[model samples]
Target: MTKAPVTPLLDRVHTPDDLRKLPKSELRQLADELRTEMIDAVGSTGGHLGSGLGVVELTVAIHYIFNTPDDRLIWDVGHQAYPHKILTGRRDRIRTLRQGGGLSGFTKRAESEYDPFGAAHSSTSISAGLGFAVANKLAGTPGKAIAVIGDGAMSAGMAYEAMNNAEQAGNRLIVILNDNDMSIAPPVGGLSSYLARLVSSGRFLGLRDLAKKFAKRLPAPLQVAARKTDEYARGMAMGGTLFEELGFYYVGPIDGHDLDQLIPVLENVRDAAEGPCLIHVITQKGKGYGPAEEAADKYHGVQKFDVITGEQKKSAGGPPSYTNVFAKSLLSEAEQDNTICAITAAMPTGTGLDKFAAAFPERHFDVGIAEQHAVTFAAGLAAQGMRPFCAIYSTFLQRAFDQVVHDVAIQNLPVRFAIDRAGLVGADGATHAGSFDVTYLATLPNMVVMAAADEAELVHMVHTAAKYDSGPIAFRYPRGNGTGVELPETPQQLEIGKGRMVRGDEKQGRKVAILSLGTRLAESLKAADQLEAKGLSTSVADMRFAKPLDSALIRKLMATHEVIITVEEGSIGGLGAHVLTLASDEGLIDAGLKIRTLRLPDLFQDQDTPDKQYDEAGLNAPQIVDTVLSALRHNSAGVEEARA
Candidate 1:
């Protein structure tokens, strides 16, 4: 049996202020308790596990050394901030992570004053930290900005962009490169630890400043040579030549887990009267927990699990997830056509491209966290007569919208965009919800946008995208499993801009027409059933394409039905906006014709279950029925009571 952590030191500590009161000798014990507490908290409430566990000692060290809430400390991606949250007066609500009205899975500004900036995305910490640093400098404040960025996040160009401009911040900016997975440098040891201490030391910086002044008196050539010699000598021992080139005094390859090594080095950087510094700290993901250390990626984000066994709770059997379905469909297509290639921006497993990579390693590309590069790369492949499916999460794809418009859409390349998670993502919350992709992509010229109604439709859309090489095409699917729809053995290549009737059409003389987009067809049908019970005939149509709307179907519905309701699993400027434009252009709305739209609300929804989220957004079945009734001069109170 694992020994329970003795948290006498931890129980007394409710905040970082409490932690500063304890002696440095007791910090190691506090770190141990913090680790145990984090693991136990995440066990009851599933969330990001490994990253937070990896940063336990670092979190303690930073908080203990710096005056938090005054000195800004930003964690890149915010997945590693749980331990930091625990240390900063949120230990009581630790178990309520990712639930409705609970602590957010990522760092949230509204939740605490300690979080200076809200961050859930990767590689933005450096830029945000620089803003804080420069703002403090301009105000002539002693408070510094510290950004702890992961190695994976460094793959993006934004981090480098921030680093190149970090000179203005000078001594006010401190960047800690958290090298956990990528061994960017040699292993950390006593020798590496000593160098980090020396380089970051006040005495070393003082001497370095004195040397720079002395070198300036010589010729420009000698000055250049002296600088190169000093930079190269340190660069050879450590591995931050690239960071050094970006106008930062680079230090380290220090062991992050050791508080003894961390505390002093941070103190040196904190007290230094020099330019912006980059400290490279090496840590292991899932450091304290045994099972997590064995399988870091699996524990990176997890469902609830047993504390001792490290066995995650297996989800009850259901239909295949939309991601797996897309992967399978893509792999099947690639098997038939050698020209088909798969590209993912550092999310092979999340996008289900790992299976494709395992089979056709040559055709698979895992571009590390750089969505812009991934989009352009796919465009290049497509321009060269290859069918490259750029599979990215809708939120991540937003990072590359410029490339999508300039490189793919304007050029009219045959880059098949597989947009995963195209709606409200449950536990990941607002930062990860794919709410804006349909609105953004549909507005772009020369782009075909389609959303899958079910798993079978997803299979068909995949086949459709692979076959169509005329222009840039995109297909979006939700984040969860399908509605237990049967998998099609032979996937059909759907006709572009055409829709199918899921219920009664114009022939039935329906008074109510429910035009649905994406996976909202299921809920629309449910609304139709309630409408039918209330002595009202309702028609449901699954409009597959959002960009190239089936004008004939929409025109017919608007002319025949008295009440027309458009429902989609996206934001306001999507299908509803397009349909409104269509209606105004053609003057489709006749006398007494009512039109209503059901979509996600304007405000950003917080963390909750998928059902609760949809209900809150007013996109569920009852809400759809209510929208239809409200449009018509009918009693909507019946549906409201049923919903209750």
Candidate 2:
């Protein structure tokens, strides 16, 4: 358990080509150094730790084996790609992971040549890898394409779809199914169970061969024969299987961490000139590290930690986070109302619903990582007169947009969406950013969208969503701690589509006005104060509801202020777009009132601290103040000089 000093090998690796030159024996030493550096790096900046540790050897082996810049290797979900980042020429920038203008937490094509394919979301790697493989074949390039996907990710329909199509295309492709036995938590669903059995049985080389025992004695064809034999055996052994029917030549149940086992099997799969192949390699979640191996989920994503003790660095703070508050409030409501129920798409602890699950086991549902099913399931429960609260991360909810539109919104189901991680999520980068939900959900006909200003507001939103049986209701709150706001004794429902004025002078000569949404209210208030100090009076309104635009408040602000600025945490089609649409309808533009909307830029914002990200997006206090002043000066110049 001795801590090794960060060595020169760690320092020198700024690219994969550099890594390819080193001897295979030196890789073990490099992996040890990489693990130490990763532990140390993530210890300082809170980020995903255990996944990176689990993939160290596999990452090393793949980069060493494949001609990376030419041969594309796609990583699924990107959470586990931290070590991949380190070895693939981003080692020097590793310290800057998740910081503004720093290294991204996931695979990004723009970041390096090694990351030929970028991924932030789960269940996307296989499809992306197939694209690369097909492209390589068309170009007649001397390159290989591989997808290192986990067993948990394979449960998703998209991966299977890719496998079906890839096998039919008959391209030389390799798929390494990294069976880590955990996906954030112990993986769920039937696919996970089948994979577990696959691991236990160890590749089905002799399920029942009518052809002969010598098929097992054959070299490359052994995998093909085993899959054919296993398919027939599975008809009677369990149920008629789905994978081989899809056409993928399934191999493995190999030990992933065993370099000897992994290298040769991968070599065999690589050498074989045939259709799509899957190498199912079983690996413990936290292979090399002891603490991570013991507590896989806890170490899944960790804060700066003491490497020796495996204790996360504590931030001196107070009170429950918004997520915790929402969970507690929901549980309290569920206790009183039998009709109240909760559903999460694979996230239990992350959404803080573990408490609710403990209290009301019957009402709690974890629908694996299937967001689409989670939404429709909530809708179904609502149809039966139950108030179902579907708690999911804002980014994840994007995957179920069609369900929200068709099933819940169209039917006007009483489904409450308690959306966590609503705003700028730090470190995880653009792939995990919850920036588009406000826009996407707000436009739906019967849907109600609300954002929490603080923990207290989140409590109210939770109560509001629970009690109101009108239609589908959504309440969004940002990631991390609340602003130390005291929670109400009991939740109170706010009037729908009504906005609360945060700061403004009723008599001030309409110099400026700001309508803000979500957690960005604090920054807007600060900017208003700064604008007031400079003899530039300003008003700030918290447009709590993104949907059902607060028309009364918008009209009032338009009448008073000469300049209007809308601010929100989401992207192009969000709160700002709604504001502009309202303005155009009211003919505010023709009235010569200057208005500008501020939001996240068109391009993806890289990994950074949340505050830094907002600042970069021009949503911070200084940026807001500067934007207002500049707009005012431009207006005054055009009018005053011409009148003079």
Show where candidate 1 strays beyond 4 Å.
1-5, 636-644
Per-prediction count of colliding residue pairs?
0, 5
Residue-level error in angstroms, candidate 1, position 205:
1.8
Q: Candidate 2 regions off by >4 Å?
A: 1-30, 182-230, 233-241, 504-511, 588-592, 634-644
lDDT of each: 0.92, 0.79
User: Over the full model, what C-alpha lDDT does candidate 2 score relative to the true structure?
Assistant: 0.79
lDDT per residue for candidate 1 within 167-196, as digits (tens), equals: 999999999999998559687779988999
Which tens-of-lDDT digit does each residue in 48-85 have in candidate 2? 87777888888877887777777788898787888888
